[model samples]
Each structure stands twice: as C-alpha cells, then as structure tokens.
Target: MPICPSCGAAVAGAVATCANCGHPTGPAVVPPPAIGEVVVDETAAPGPSPWGSGRIHQDRQWPTPSRGWLTAGRVLLAPTALLVVLATLGSTIAGRGGSGVDDDPAVRWTVHTFQMWLQLTLTAFGTPWRNSNSSSFGSSTSGIHVLPYAVAFGWLALLWLGQRLTARARAAAGAAEPTGPAAGAQALRTGALSAVAVLLLGWLSTGSSHVDEDSLSLSMQVTTGPAMLPLGLSGFLAAAAVVLAVDGQGALRAEAARRRWLGGWLLAWQHAARVVGALLVLLTLVSVVMQVLVDQPFPQSTFRALTVNGGVYLFGVGSGARAGVGGLRGGHEGTFALYDLGAHGGQWWLTVVPVLLAALALGWSAHRGRLTQLDRARLAVLYAVLTAALVLGTSIWLSESSTIKGQVHEARIELLGWSVTSVVVAAAAWAVFGALVVPAALDAVRRTPVPVSVPLPAQAADEPDGIVGTVELVAEERPLVGQVDVLDSHAAYRRPDAS
Candidate 1:
C-alpha cells in the first residue's frame, strides 16, 4: 500500500495517482548532506573563462578564520571613523572657545553636540554617564531626544552588513552554510570584533583622568567624562549580545517563513527578545522625530532630550527621570536621580507604554510559537522577571557616580540611575496584564467561520407502474380495542355525519 502525501489515505502500491486527493505519487524528497561531505557542481567549466564566475563556483571552500577576521574589521571601521571625526571637531571648537569667553556660543554648541553624541553612544552600549559641572542640584538638565536611537541604528547597520559579508563568504567557499553551533560561533566572532572596536574608541575618548584633592574636585579629559575600561567593555559586550540575538531572530524568521510555522523553543525565545528590543529602539526613534517637529533647537535642547529618552528606554524608567542641576548658588553641580511617582508630577504613568509593548510582544511571539496559553503566561512571567532582575542589577552596579568641586567641600553625587523596585513592579504588572489580554486578542484574529457543504439526497429513477392493488387507508394496529365497547355478536358502526 501507498500513502497519499496530501490526504494520508491508503492506496494500491501500483496506483499512478492518489485516489483520495488525486495527487501524483512518488514526489522527490531532498536528502540531507552527510558530515564531511563536499558538494560538487559538475556544470562548471574545467578551465577559467572570460568571466570569473566559473572560477568562483569551482573554488568554493569553507570560510577561513582569516576571512572572518577581515570581515569583522571592515564592518567595525566605519562607525569608529565617525566617532573620531566627531571628537576632532569638538576638540577644535573647545580650544577656540577657551581662547575667548566661556559664553562663546559656537564653541558651546559644538561641544554640546559632540558630548551628546558621545553620551548617546555610551548609553546605547549600556554605560551610564553623569554631568559633573552642573550648578543646579537635582534638576534634570536634558529632555528626551534622539541620540541613543541613532547609536542603535548605526550599531544594527554594521551588524547586518557584517552578517551579509559572512554569508557571502560562506557561499563562495562552496561548503554548507553554518547553522546550529556553527552559526552561534560565527555570531560570537562578530560580536567579539565589535566589542574590541567599541572598547578602543572608549579608551581614545577618555584618554586621561585626574583627581584634585586640593580643590576637592575630579576631572576627566573627555567632555562626557572618562568611563572605566572594564565598564566600557561590558557595555560593548551587552550591545554585541543584542546584535547577535537580532541575528538569531532573522535566521529563525527566515526558517519559519520557509516551513510556514514558528520555529523551536530557543529560536522563538530569541525572536521574542528581538521584538521587545526592536520596539524600544523604534520608540526612541519616534521621540527623536517628535522633538524635531516641535521645534526643539539642535545641540543645546536636543542633548538633554536625548538623555531623557535614553534613560527611560535603557532602564525601564519613566520620562520624568531627569538630572537636576544645582547652580553656583547651591554650591554643587546638581543632584540627579530617578524620581518616585509622587515626585515626578504624575508622569509615572508614561512607564506603561514600553512595559505594555514588551508584554504584548512576548505574548504574540509565544502564541506564534504554538505555546499553550499557560505556556505563554509562563514565558511572559519568566521574561518579565528576568528583565526586572537584570535592570535591578544594572541599576545597582552600573549607575554613574562622580565627585565634583563644591563651594564649601567635596560633593559626591550619583545620577542617571534607575529605581530597581519600580522596574520590578512595573515589569510584573505588565506581564500579568498582557498575558490576560493577548490570548483574547489572538483569538479574535484567528476566529473565522468555516464553510459547510449541504449534502443533497439521492433521487430515484422514473418508471411506469401497472395496476396491482386498490388504494385504501389501513385500520390502526389496535382497532379491536376501540370497537369492543359497542359490539354485540357482530360488530357494527354508524357514521355521525350520515345522521
């Protein structure tokens, strides 16, 4: 017996086509390649031709480590160059301004722009920063702006290009394209390369640091201030992790598209992370555009705006998160902190957007993954818990702190940090809420009326009938019982209508 591929119905072994679905039998199955197998193309010409296409097709081999290294270097160089240019321009402007008054508008604006860009890059890479020279205490100097998303945009572009080059190289080698463990290895290699590039840039930007005991002050050579190497390295690695996770998602989506279904657990989870992160990035971009449309001046106003937006997205904090500058009258630069709901003037409600979006992304991905509602709930809860834990840990360890010159004494301040408790609470609340909402939403989308076939009964063939019997109504089965009450010897009945 043969089984129909489409309908799974049994058929005779000698059948040319399936009887149930009428599909042709014996369709070909693509065989998987064996380990260490080298696939050869027999159609290529033996000798080199006018075009180099033949040679490339004939000489395909596995991607060498040297090629990988070169690819990584090329991918990382563009953004590094841009950072160098920004540094140079800022330095020139600062030197020219120092030759004049402290209020030199051109120099101030240029320096502010450069510092903002640098800060955005650091934030995107996961390093928190501080403003050491602010005169106001606890006044947020900057508003929500565009720089962080800009950094993210550049980072993702480089990563995508790197992956594309690696894929091209793999194809040229004529070996099997890497997947599973091999893909992981490739992603790690790329991430390592990117980390090195970012670490070097951080070192260059923050070349020197000095502590002044006499004046009770600390100053760094960079405008945005110097970051510790280890911290910068960790931040770079975090960014790299985001990139690799995104790459994994691209692969998963591609596979899913081919198979017409969601991928396995690991891929699905990666996809979920990718969705949430991408949404955050998108939100940042939108904030940037909104600032511009509202006529927020460039550099001065935009710098603070960028910081506000970056702080919120990176830490799961609200837009009310800001740094308060205590001017000279206060004897300190400023006191900056993630304010409580009561202190933030009701802006705490703004935190709901990202948390809600994150939960929705998680739920949708879980549904697409073919998980049960229970599984979706579990996944949502797990993701939220982990995010909260991670944010809390980052807030504790990665919060930026510095000592600045004060009128009376040395002032040490901690700023640009998140509230661990708030983050945890919001994450849990959003996850629970989204878990309840998402299933119903997906159900509505999937609901459709199934069309039914109304079956018709079979009709008999027409035929002529010969006379065989008289037409009459038969007596009921219990006729004797009804007539017994009036019967005497022979039974008789009178019709009421005849009388």
Candidate 2:
C-alpha cells in the first residue's frame, strides 16, 4: 500500500487511486526540456475584448496653431461672403444712381458707396468709424457710433449657428465637454481671429469720394480706427454663448456659484442676453405693426429708421442738433439744442417696454430654479450696468460741412447724447423693480395661507344650556422640507373635562 501525498490516504491499487479520498497517489511524471525553455499559459492570456477598446479618452483635442488658422479662415469665408452680398444689396437699393456723373464715375461711385455700407455694417458689429469732409473753404471731422441692430442681429445669428454646428460636430465625434481652460483658450483664439479679420476688412473698406465742379470742390472720406476691445468682446461673447447653449444653463449656474467674481459676470451676461433678446423681439413686433400701418416704399429706409428709433427708445436718451457758420476770417458757433425723443418725450409708454421685458426674463429665470433672491438682485444691477455701457458704446454722432460761395456751413447731430448718468439711474431702478421686487411680491402672494372655519366638538349634555360650542378657525400651512411638503394646521379648542 502507498500513502496519498495530498490527503494522507492509502492507495489500494497500482492505478494510483487513494481508497478514502480517490486522490492520485503516484509519483508525478515530468517532461524533460531541450536546451533552455520557458513556459507560458496560453489560456490565461487575455483575449479580444467585446467592447473593442479598453477606455474611451475624454479630453478635448484642441486644434494646432496652423489648423486653428485654417479653421478660422474657413469660418471667415462664409461671413465675408454674406457681408459682401448684404452690402451689395443695401448699396444697390439705398444708393442714389450716379445721375450727374459719367459711366466710369457712376461705377466708381457705386463701388465707393458699397464700401461705405460695408464699413457701416462693420461699425454696427462693434467697429469704430471716423468720417471727415473737406472742401475749398473748410473741413469737418466726426465719429459715428450708432448700431444698426438689424445688421447686428443677422451677424449674431450666423455666429450662433456656426458655434452650434461646431459643438455638435465635436459631440458626434465622441468628444467630451471641454474643460474651463480649454474653453477659455478657444474663446481667446476666436476673439483674436475675429479682431484681426475685422481690422483687415476695415482697412480694405476705407473709402473717399471726390466732387470736382466748376466753382466748388468737395471730398468726403470714411475710415475705421483701432477697435480691438469692441471686436474682441463681440467675438468672446459669441463663443461664450455657444458654450452656454451646448453645456446648458445648469452648468452655467453651477459655475457661477463656484467662482464668485468670474461666475457672477457669466451669470450677468446670461441675464443681459435674455433682457436684450426680449427687448429686440418687442421692438421687432412694434416695427412690424408700424410697417403694416404705414405704407413705406423703401423698406431699407424703414428698417434703418425703426432700428435707430428702437435703439433710442430703449436707451432712453434724446437727440441734439447744432449748426455753425464759417467764413475766410472767423466762424460763428451755434448752440446745441436737444430734442426729447426718448422715454421722456411724448411717447412715455416706451419706458414700459424694457420693464415688461425684464419682468418676463426674471420670471423665466425663477422658473428655472437654482438662483436665490440675492443672486437675482446682483444680476439686476449687473444687467443695468451692462445695458448702460452698451448704450454709451453705441451712441451716435454725425457732423457734416459744405462750402457754399466760400462761406462754409456745418451741421452736427448727436443721438443718445449727454444723459448717460440719467440713463444708468433709470435702468437700475427698472431692473430692480422688474427683476427682483415684482417677482418676490408675486411669489409671496402665491405662498400666502388661506383661512378656513371648522365647528368645535359639542359640549356635554349635562353642562349648562347657555354654554354653546364655539367655532374654531384653522389655517392650512405648507412648510417645505427638502423636496417634500409637510402640512401643518393650528386651531384653539376647549376640552370636555376642563372647567
């Protein structure tokens, strides 16, 4: 008999089987190796995974400098083409056919006018412009800062669409949401590219017109100066809008709550966008109604008038006019007279437009949740500040000079002039009332408790007959506990056992 090495059982036969445990009890057989050999278990090695890859990379892959430039170039082409087409159509429609000039002169005039419209459109999109006129007698220079919201609206639409498409493309390619630094870098790149492109376009759009006559000669020129801040800000905002749209509002609110200063600005921008967007919608509706009521032959002129008027009404600033006369020796200065055409004018109802819009925007924000009363108050103040700054940036100034029999006459007009502090004060008051006070008041009304009367239990029959059961007044109160509401009611009652 042989004992089993593993279980300490005795083998019963030569077949090497243990009697008690049925274990192998024979000496192990070993194979001999030739030279040097290494062994590996093929079964233990990993096979092909069913999920294809091990881990999906989540980091955003930013474009290289060269690649970024190429992408920016591609993005530039569409807007550039659109701008050119719009400028051409606007120039063709609004331009006075060069009736007094030859074919060559007419062509030159058309081209220059087209360039002027292009510059104006650029100016509407935050570029700054300088206008100068010189003649045989005198010269005048002025800067125009009026924003044509129609053009701006179109450009912003295009920018928003482009960003949306880009974000979708990245998502389709299995890319994750971009980190803060990555998003910031992308915005900076977009802003820098936009600024450079705007500068180049401004340089190309500079135009001058000359009128040479028998006795009098006049020359007028339009050019753009450095507008790095405005152009870059426009681009940065466009990029940020895309990020907000893609990431959703919850993320924005969370980010704002995390970083007080930077987050507060982002939150304020969100409110500003909502406020301005609503105002634009209201203005558009008014313009449509005006168009329907009034028969205007030139749609372009109608559009220009509506945009300018809407801007003036929303900013609550008046227009002013000034005229001066100059000779070879000296010039007589004229007093600047302001015309009340804004909210303070005959159309005082215009003040209600922004108020109503701000109220609606604040309501929407509250419905979305996550904002406290303090956050909303801060948002209102920031919105007012932003709107006032925007009004300041878009204020318009126009100056013109002409030489008549060597005695020059000059006229200047300023729209949205000399009342910035007043506008700021008004905006702040309206924003607070509409965005904070009104909403809070409404919420309080909605949460108020309603009282109900309930009869008290009958007194004992043995008690005095004159002692009657009094009615108990109860009120339903709901206190919020986390996501659930607990009902609590109170009423006074006398017990039967009490004297």
Q: After superposition, how far is residue 175 of candidate 2 from its true place, in Å?
A: 1.3
Per-model TM-score on C-alpha atoms:
0.49, 0.57
Question: What RMSD, rounded to one decimal, does every model reach?
Answer: 28.2, 18.9
Model 1 over residues 1-499: C-alpha lDDT tens digits? 4445555566666667777778776752123235566555567566543221212245654544454455556666665665556555544554466334375555465544454445445555545554343322321122211234445446566666655665554344333333334445545665677677766666544422333444745332323443446445754565456445543443554454344224323333554567656665655664565565645321223243243344344346532233332223222234333353334345346555665666677656644544444445555666666566444432211223333343234333322334444566766766665554675577568762111211111111121221111111211222234323221211111121222
Prediction 2 global C-alpha lDDT: 0.50
Candidate 2 residue lDDT tens string, 35-140: 3554333433355322312223334446444533444455555555666677677666655443333445345446676776677777656555566656655566
Note the Cα lDDT for every prediction shown: 0.46, 0.50
Candidate with maximal TM-score: 2
